[model samples]
Target: MSKKVIELDALEQINLDAAGIDIGAESIYVAVPPGRDTESVKEFPTFTADLQRTAEWLKKCKISTVAMESTGVLWVPIYEILEHHGFEVFLVNTYHLKNVQGRKTDVLDCQWIQQLHTYGLLKASFRPPEEIVEIRGYVRHRDTLVKYRSAHIQHMQKALNLMNLKLVNVLSDITGVTGMKIIRAIIDGERDPYVLANFRNKLCKKDEEEIAKSLEGYYRPEQVFVLKQSVEQYDFYEKQIQEVDQQLESLYKKYDPPDEDNYKNRKKHKPRKNQAHFDLGDSLYRMAGVDLTKIDGVDALIAQKVLSEIGTDMSKWPTVKHFTSWLKLCPNNKVTGGKVIQTGTQKTKNRATTALRIAAFSLSHNNKSALGSFYRRIKARNGPSEAITATAHKIAKIIYFMLRDKTDYYDLGENYYQEKFREILIKKLHKQAANFGYYLEPYNMAIPLVS
Candidate 1:
């Protein structure tokens, strides 16, 4: 038997001017295409000056593009530096670099990344425009503060429990006006249940007498101290959140069109529960050039979140399919022998995707919007979870069209959509009858008068 020899095909280098870096906290490993320089692979210390020097070195080597893994927060500074230095930076997810088979090292990873990028095999992750990124940072920090406030609320509840106070049981929100007033009075040495009940808000569902009974507890000094601190911390976070909202509003004004009257005639969407305290609807409408909140199930907060993650530039995605794929709302099809073996959506940490899913879930209880009808139709066959994902995917497509066209969403009501679908079903039924050599006609039940 003759030994067989196999030839490996070489991939054409499409980006001859590309370079890649294996970034780290303490140092970075940089690589360029072969023969680019005497020292193709070099290590640079992780410092501002060193990063500048690295950029200078890449420029000297005639490198125009740079690729790097999304290595935690370490890649951010270098990415900005490279971007500032007029180099196109591709921040690739680490998962894409995993398919390169070899003994992996920092040096090898840079080489592999450079090789892959040269062949245009890697894709850069979607990052919103720079201005939106700044707003995103503030919004994300505000979310943390809000979560921290919730933790304090839980702490207050625990302290009340330890002191045998049933305030939470009587009040819907322990952080609301009534609960806070009673808690402040308790911490201020007002031990009488009747006096604490006197501070309850009139709108609270529980009667003042019943609230007085709930407030009666063996109040211990230690738990009371904890309760006081919790309330103070919650109050501090609330003030901080207020400041963040102000900052967001101010930042948002930068994009407000000089002619606010353009949106004055636009239909106003009802504010969502726990929506941002500021008037984000008008700003978002102006910025997006469309009112996304008009879409059923999409509230002001969710609209803001989706826009922040995706920006107002729908041009980044050429089509609705591409947009949904990037959002990880579409199915990832794996085929074997020309048959699909697995079909599932890519699991993502994208906040926009999460917000869309939540919005879709909310539509499960609604029967008015076309989207809600579609959700129920899907939910009938698949479970609620799959229905939510599918409905969110549809919403993603609607959003793509609305943003790309800069047009307001005009929903065809659920009744209209269902009627159209019913017509299509009737046509299909007629075709089936014809195939069986039978004619089909509309049936009406009416009796002729026998006068």
Candidate 2:
């Protein structure tokens, strides 16, 4: 028996002036609609001049929208150029563009993207506004510097360990004031344990005698040299990080100055160890038009990092659900034959999602906040991993609404959440009892216990 072939209606063209580009490290293949020009598809070298010519060619073909696969950093220059030329540039995800199965080549990919985009079958990936992008760059670089500095810190620790120094045992952080001073004194040829211990800060929990005991180590020249070099690298990265902070401060100046009264009235928070030196809370509040730090477990640093990643413009997401879905915090339920086969959140490298997760994790130890209670309740039902995602989802929704509606966060207390949860449990119990041909009555504690 011969199989019947199904002939579906052709997809209607929705973007008449759409074009597609397959960008590569050395060259790019561009495809315009058929009959737009004598040569509908053309290849261009990946040079600034050639990119300009590519834009000019697209203009010649009357293309006003362009779709391109996000092929690493290769697409950034072209995307910026096309956007600058006033074309609606869609930086399409590779996954979306890979659904169509056929012979694959750069030329074929460009044409396929063009065909899909022309029919409005493509979605542009979310990219924050240019101002946010600038802040993101600086913030990311600072994070990198911090990571690099951490490695040098480990190096210093290793050198200390080789020489039998036990500073890490007594101090919370080797980069702290007392630790740094002792380390500098060691690098400066001070071998006397008593002299090194004298550098201890007044706030140090360890007394001079205890610090001196820890400082008693063999003064190996080789280990001392490594410690010196590691400290130098650490200081260098510190300087670089400070420079980036200054740049960020200057960038924040471009935005509207924050309200002085509001800034002064805001609650002061103890700065994190690696937090930027500037008034990050004020700058972030000014940019976002709301103090995200007002939310529990979301400090100014986390707020700054998240805002830099996602920007303050919530219109890009149509709703709070859409925002969380974009962050990949919501579960992607896979159903087969009306049965759920899988339900898990998609793995994503979104920085905003990471920041939200960090904020959620911080709430694990907070007992006073309603969100903390919710997190603990979820953790009791599911495992810790699921609890983190669930709490992050809640936080993401709160952030979305706060930013979208321009409203302040007013956290209901932990007791309130607990009472509401108790009420819900009572209602569930009553319904279950009714289903079992019984009714629930309030438990009485007024009666005295029998002896």
Candidate 3:
């Protein structure tokens, strides 16, 4: 009963005595044969220290292939270390190993993982090279900083509102040329909203003298200070965002990943141009459905975050649902006797999912999008949380096709679903009516098949 679940029979030519190591934040537990199953599990400090020493110990034990669970982002360093030691490392999902009651422990986890590795029941999770990972990290960090800045801006806006400043009523963006000038003056101790209004762009139709006169307002000194601080923080984050953009430009040039123009360019263009199209290590930017800007509020940083979280090799998945399920975006099922079931969605949503949801929320207001329509559809049916997830799932599927197939994406337009809406409604109605004994005749009156 114990046999290898081989993917390719050709791989039968290769020798395997694969080991498994369950890595935890606190420690690492490795499993091997010819030792007390659970007792032989070797524990090591989960740090950069003694990485070489660990490799040496593994070498002495003659361990070749290794498998480990993906424990958040912590698994990366260990994976890199293991890979450097000339061992075939398989980064796997925890879901693959179903631990029963009274059968789970650090040692047992390692043993179970090892058994899978030996039997080839494990598949390596998609991992781009270190440079791509580095690129992704920078991009994701930049997005976090952007969100932080936006939050600060919102807080500042609330402070301004509480101060009875009607500046927002007059100006489109408080950070705009005229508004900033007026805000700066106020923060620098000017007590008048009228003065801020007067700071509007020279092109403003509002009379400056009259605006300045109306800007007068009673504002708390403490509130002004808090607003000023928030504005200053927001500015600081803005500066950081620009710096991150500069950093991203370099990564974009480095790993262009596959896409429509990229593939065509690769085939038609020379090596010099091809180098420009894909990353030196791996071209993640060029992957399928890599809009890099499709989801609402997803800038370069967010684009990098989504692509980096799940690489472009979608063929590894049977479908977009499979990919999303792997990301733990779907329900985890517990079934008995194939009749009754306990089902609930994944308790932990991924970081990428959070980022996507945030972007989807921002997209709700964007009328220039298929994404907006998708958002509205889900939001109408469920709630904001489910809507966000639905949009994110749609995005994930899009990304899967875009990267894996190296295709181009264009928004189908907001009316896309609407255009086909009647057809969809009719089909659903037909199904329901059929069960209720209300048969629907074909619009064209059923034509006989010309067999």
Candidate 4:
């Protein structure tokens, strides 16, 4: 007897007006529905004029929406141009387009994307407003510049080490005011350790005698040349970073501030280890409409990074859970046969996640903050990695609430979280006892127990 085969159900099309484009470095292959008085697939050069023409062709075809894989920075220009042309462009991640598996080519890929989008199977990645996008670009470029400056500092340290100088040992920051002055003097042929030590400021914590001892090194001419060049490059990058900071401040001021006079009565917070060149704390608070720097372990620099990753608009994420998931901070649970299999957070290169993790690491040094207490508690049970992820997750939730509600984060205190955690443990114990047909009562530690 012949076996009967069951056919798969067809997906209903929800977006009949959708189009798709397969983006490449030099060309883009766009696909629209067949028999729409337009070629089903057409290849266009990856140029501004070509992109404009493609947008115009889509408009002529009455296409209202488009979906394309985020191949690279190549998609950015087309995305913006299509957006300008009033097309609802969906920038889907490459991973999300793997549902239709088979022999893949340029034409096939574009056709597949068009079909999937027509059935409403594609999800667009979160993108901020155009203004925020511009600000993000500036913020990221500044971060790169700072990294370059740090590399130059390392080069200076290497040069100093070659000369047997222990400046890094005595001075916490070798690029600080006093250290730079001493280094400059050394380059100018001041070889006396006492003279270099005299350049130290009274505010510096290191004693003059120790600094003098540390400054005494076998100064070779080549190493001195290297050090001078390193310092000059570092200074150049510093000026560039300052210009970027000025741009950031100007752009941030364009946002509507919650209170025009709030800056007048604002108390200056403690400076960060590497604070921005501008008044980032006040500017971030005004732009975010909340004082994010008030959160435990968050400083002005961290707040700026967070705001750059995700703008002040919280509506981009529907809920806090969605935001955390997008950051890859939440656990991905796999279940089979109604049994749990695996639960672990998916790794991601998200900047917000990295910034939150850095903040979580800083929390380990603060023993009194609520987040610090929570981190210690989790660390005791799950070790350091889990503790960091948990703490970062908590921070992501706190940020979400602050941005969504336009409210400041009020510290609840470590004791409050601990007390609530104790209550939860007691409730779990009671539930377990009742499952075994027994009753459990709250234990009073203040009262003596009678046998």
Candidate 5:
């Protein structure tokens, strides 16, 4: 009798070929691989009950790997459900699994991912680790709430401006203390914007005086009602932002220095000399370092935005160019027979690039910074835009090394290759000077006079 042996072909690490799940908001399309006995693909709904049923159903099939495209946040729930159920699940990128135009259909999208996956042809994007994923959700939702609040604030501004309430003219913030009090009084049937502006606290006396001058906009009770709704929405978002910040504060401890609070007393006392220097990820301030702030012109916020979006996972990128290329930074190359078509990448208008631009602009005014030198260095050849990108590209490389190597940043010095270039220049100049019979000395010699 032959001993029983388990035969496997479709299984790779992470269950690469069991089935394919394509997710939409309300529905999910699952594609079971072609079986020896079946001809058409398997189809199913992906409801909670249906998902539980799928576990029992898939066990009956001989699928060894499960693959799916990450459609949206919708894909996440199902992916977790399926992965939790022990199916090999792949969260593939839509870019990597592009289908031929005519052959594309929703159901076929799942089928395509399955087909590519079965043949082991699927490539996936870099997903952050589980900790990063969880942290990302919190950070992303906070961003959405912030944007929502901004929209509400803008609507209120438009409403007030429409009413001709010079409240904005008098005060920088219509939602500010003096402005809010006057707006509320107006909504409550206060006639005089003057009387309303006077509703200031002791701290708001100066603000009140200025707001009174600008409280001259047109007033309608109906418009005031509309403004109230928008103000409420703004308040709701503010609350949400606060809650998220609390969560972030708790999570930040992992990256913050153990003695962060000690910084207050750092001027009076020093850390133990035996202690090691810290990495950038050690604090929000330190992490700001990777954001190219040392390059000058890069703001803390922009630097933080870059780190927040991509995390410190430079290993996903082999080089700094690869990282920027992923960001659509350099240029998009569409070619036929190696002839170029589009010269530059589509304008992404990403925060990271904005930070880089800030750095570039700063260089224009900053003569002491290496970023300033780099800007001048490249501006002579490529112009401001390219020079900024070149500087940004350099910053990205610096960021990668800082994050991946877990090292402190050291400036390359404004004259990074100055000694080498000087040596070469001296040799060339001396060769000519020698022919002319005039003795020459190397320009870089610290003591020019021979002692």
Candidate 6:
């Protein structure tokens, strides 16, 4: 028997001018096409001047495009510099680079990336427009501050507990109007429980007498000190969050203003807890060209968060399905031998998905909306987790179409949804009965039974 040799054709070079970069904290590895220079691969320091030199060398090699892994924040500077130099930058996800079989090193990684880019095998990750990116930065920072503030609020609660105070048990939130006033008075050296309770707001559910009893506690000096410091820290973060809200407001103003007539008849909704002090509904409406809050269970805060993550551009996704798949809200089924082996949504840290899920969960409190009815129906069939994912997926599709077409959301009401669902159930029953050689009929049409 003769041994046959196999020959494979090389992949077509789609991006001849492509280069690759492996970014590091203090250094960067760059790779260009062979023969572009004496050394096709080189290492450059990550300093600003050195990054500028790296760009110049790539330009000298006639490279017009670059591919790099979205490593931590280390890749950000290089990506920006390359983009500033007018080079087409592809911020490829690191997971996509893990499929190649080989010993992994910085030099080899850059070479592999370059090879992939030459063959047009890499897909760029989605990044919103620059303006949206700016808004995202501020929004993310605000979220961090909010988290910090929450920590201090817990600290205040711990101090109160140590002092044997039951203020939290009396008031819904210690940071609310009545709670804050009483807390400030306590910090200001007011030791009389009745005097502190005098600061109670009119809207407080508990009577002044009850509040006074809750305030009568063993206020140890050490615990009071902790409480004072925690209050100060919480106030500091609150100020910082307000500043971020101001920045967001400024950014929103840069977008085309919304038509006043559209909001003329809009119902006013009080801001939810920890929501921005500014008019987030109006700002988001102006920026997105659609009132996302009109969707059932989506409030101004949820809409703002989703918009900040995905921006106003729905063109990034080709269709609604693509949008939900990117969010990992839809099930990803894996099959083998024509049998599905796995089915579930991919785990993701996508903030937009989280916001949508929160919006979906909020529907449980609203039984009159169509989305609320749909959520309940799903929850009955599956568990709460599955229900939340399905509802979030549905909401995501609605948002995609709304943003893409710049249309308003109109709820058909829960009654309409229930009737439609009933019709669907009837159709399914009829089909099943026919398959079993039986027929489904109205009760009035059924044969009478003898006693």
TM-score of each: 0.92, 0.95, 0.70, 0.93, 0.67, 0.95
> Candidate 6, which ten residues in sequence have the lowest lDDT sum?
263-272
Which pairs of residues have clashing backbones in candidate 1?
A: none
**What global local distance difference test value does model 5 have?**
0.64
lDDT of 6 by residue, 1-451 (tens): 3657789888898999999998888898999999999999999999999999999999999999999999988998888898999999999988877765556675678998998999999999998888888999998898899999999999999999888889999999999988888888888899899999898889889999999999889989988899999999999999999999999999899888888988765546657789997998889888988888888889888888899899888989998888998999988999997799999999999999999999999998756889999999899999899999999999999999999998888899999999999999999999999999999978864678669
- Candidate 4, 1-451: lDDT as tens digits: 3757989888899999999999999899989998875578889998899999999989888899999999868999999999998999999988877865656776678888998899999999988889889988998998899899999999999999999999999999988888899989988999999989999998899999999999888999999999999999999999999899889989989977757565554446687545777778778877888888778888888888888889988998888999999999999999997777999999898888999999898889756878999999999999999999999999999999999998767778899989999999999988999999999876899999899
lDDT (Cα, 0-100) at 432 in candidate 5: 94
Q: With candidate 2 superimposed using the best TM-score fit, by how many Å does residue 172's alpha carbon deviate from the native?
A: 0.9
Please give the RMSD of candidate 1 to the true structure: 4.2
For residue 60, model 6's alpha carbon misses the true position, in angstroms, by: 1.3
Better of 1 and 6 by TM-score: 6
Q: What would the TM-score be for candidate 2 when compared with the true structure?
A: 0.95
In the range 93-129, model 1's lDDT, one tens digit per residue, is 8887776665677568898888889999989988888
Cα lDDT over the full model 4: 0.89
The per-prediction CA RMSD against the true structure, in angstroms, equals 4.2, 3.3, 8.4, 3.6, 10.0, 3.6
Residue-wise lDDT of candidate 3 within 1-451, one digit each (tens)? 4655866654331325667777777888777754534345677787688555666667777788888888888888878888988988888867655532236675678887777677666777767666667767876786588679878878777877887776666666666677678777888887755556656788765677656654566678987888889888988987787777667566566544555553443312112210221232223344333454543445543555666676555676888788888766666788876654786567655667776766678778855677887788778888788887777777777767777775656667778767677689889999999999898977664676668
lDDT of 5 by residue, 1-451 (tens): 3657887787453443356667777666667766622633555566788776665566667665677776756777666766677776667867667652436687676776666676677766656666556656776686678778889888888888888776655566666666677767876788765687678656653565566666766777677888889888988888887777667555655663534553332221123211112322234443332324443454444454566667766888888778778666677778976588667665765555665566566667656556567678788888888887777776666677877775545455667645555678788988999899997854686756677
**Model 2 residue pairs with clashes:** none
lDDT (Cα, tens digit) per residue for candidate 2, span 1-451:
3757989997899999999998889999999999999998899999999999999999999999999999888999999998999999999999877775657675777888898899999999999999899999999998899999999999999999999999998888999999999899899888899988888888889899998999888779999999999999999999999999999999987789777766666666777799888898888878887778888889988888899999999999888888999999998999987799999999999989999999999989855889999999999999899999999999899888889888878888999999999999999999999999999877689977689
